[model samples]
Target chain A: MYGNSQFDGSAAFSGGGFMPSQAIPTADPSSPAKSREAQGLLPLTVKQIREVFQASDDKANFLIDGVSVNNVKLVGLLFEKTERVTDVSFVLDDGTGRIDCHRWVQESLDTKEMELLSNGTYIKVHGHLKGFQGVKQLVVYSVRRITDYNEIPNHVAECIYVHCYNTRTRKMQDAPQATGQLPNPAVNTPSKGYQPTSSNHSQFSVQPIVDGMKGIDKIVLNYIEQPSCIGKENGIHRAELAKQLNVPEHKIMEAISSLESEGLIYATVDEFHFKSTVNG
Target chain B: MDTSNPAAFVNAELLRMYVGRRVRAVIQVLRNDGGSIFGKSTDEQELVVKGHPPNPPTTFVEVIGIADSNRSIQAEIWTNFGDNFDVSSYNTICQLANGDFKHLFI
Candidate 1:
């Protein structure tokens, strides 16, 4: 049994994932799909739309009516004077609630169809409710021109959907498979003297060196400026240098450990410095 | 970049000792978990050896190959410790030229 729900519009799906069957709302018995041609023109107010459907607790399909549209924005088509197939959607704000109005124009709708529905054109849409990934929407069947300028307070003609696809099926075209063989890594070899700095190593070096160390290059320069008798004499004591640099002692210790391991620096007792030519 | 090439990591000083001699060697990478040895004909390829999480001391690696006209075999050991190890670490060792292998443990 469904309990009392707080959702204002017809109860619809609530989570996100594509479930096509649950998306489409059933048409009202009086407004049969077959009678679309005879019921060609029906004048209805926004309030009447709200009275017809009750919000459901189900997670599949729901209806949204009497919602105010908002955030009407536009995107441009590439070729000038050429109308391309596009899909548009807008946010429907109903003061108490909000939902997205999604429109899907099939690829089959050619340039001619786009010409008929130019940008900034206001049209009344007759559609059934559909839900996708728990979001309630109106899957428009047919749209007619609405001469009333007041209906569409905001008009933006923008193509929001872009896809690489086959013209007929609208399915994505397959991209060329990567050669299947690994690329020759030789070409990507690093230049000589170029040393990679690790994020952890740099973080360790910077934070412990200077208060709020902004530039890593500056810290490395500072370290280089203070020759620690790395190669010529006993290396600088890591703990002593860390204190002088005003950096976290632990970070400096870690950096010293890594540098010593990498042969870039040498350690003697508690001191660390650049490796001597003889030792290096 | 191509650490898989055995010649790239071979000590240049050791290589000069042989000059134009062809030496065959098997580079093996031993995992910390006693996993299978990663054997390769050339040191050109990179071998990724992972460390157990939670509390890992460090991961060990070695580049082994023949040098001095196959008269002598050489191995360079290195340690890497962190959350995500760099692929360059493997390549860096492979590109060491002429430098003493002991220099790595400065």
Candidate 2:
């Protein structure tokens, strides 16, 4: 291996099964071709992993929470109760559950980083999901050490957003199609301020509140429709909105702004306090 | 971390990981070439083995050897010689795409 001494750790990978390719070097099993798919990756708890085991039709293809998982990613703390193999085997726990993660080779062993990978340390695992003998395990591609504890909660929140966005979009498309009309009839029209969709027009009949609205806007309308938020008389506060959807305050403000401009939600007491037109 | 370098391709590192470890992976023997047997993974990547194991594709094979790259592996395959592969160790190969978009799951 005629190479620079700076890449000393790189040699460890080539020792057993690999011979440094004079032709072309394939870095790790993770390839560039797969990354083009931007949608559908989920961050899951151990309890949710059981769904993948039941959902996978075969070992090669699998789904988690009805979303087709090309590669399953998860964040969790290391659990050390499991048996160890040379350069393989890591059991992870994210409080909701625990699962085994295996690597084909040992990358960082007998090092401070390996020591730091002890029980209870948070790690972000990007890997392929595998099921063996009715149990699921992750055939890890790469494992990153998580420095910040907040990343754990953020990871879960992002997964919820992605899943919610996908499902809501699917539901929106389905609602229009149920009326036996062309889907997305609003394509050609510019809203002169909250135009009711032609397909939904007959369905809503007397109620304009069931008009053509985006997912988050519809959810906000529903939130105001709730007794607790509406019972406040002044309406739900801004801080409560940011907390409920688990989004930033600014994002909630944006949605609220659009809803107000569309004449859907109206301010009651202050800018943050809002009541939907239908709820009133 | 370096994406420009072809050597930094993820499959290359994967080859290094599988070396010497006995993995029960699902493999399809595309063709057997006398002393050398060539196979295909479920991910549709090429798998080359220097030694012979069994006939038929889409079956389980017990493999232990070295990985030259993610696509090219030199495995001493142990076939189940039955309709199914091994229960405990068959490698169920899958190509994963990470959210960061930086990870290349081949």
TM-scores of the candidates are: 0.20, 0.35
Model 2, range B1-106, lDDT digits (tens) per residue? 1112111111322444545432323355667765656655544556676665555433433343455555565655443323343322212211121133212211
lDDT for every model?
0.32, 0.50
lDDT of 2 by residue, A1-280 (tens): 5575475575665433331121121332443222222122356555556545354344545544344454557776676624345555778754345678876555554233345566655689877666677767887656778754345435655554444444444455555322121111122221321333343442232133345566777667677767677567788887888898787888788889877765666898777799755432
Root-mean-square deviation (CA) per prediction = 30.2, 22.0
Q: Return the top candidate by DockQ.
A: 2
Per-residue CA lDDT of model 1 for B45-86, tens digit only, reads: 433222221123233222223343332333322222222333
**Model 2 interface CAPRI class:** incorrect
State the interface C-alpha RMSD of candidate 2.
Answer: 17.2
Off by over 4 Å in 1: A1-86, A90-99, A132-135, A147-280, B1-106
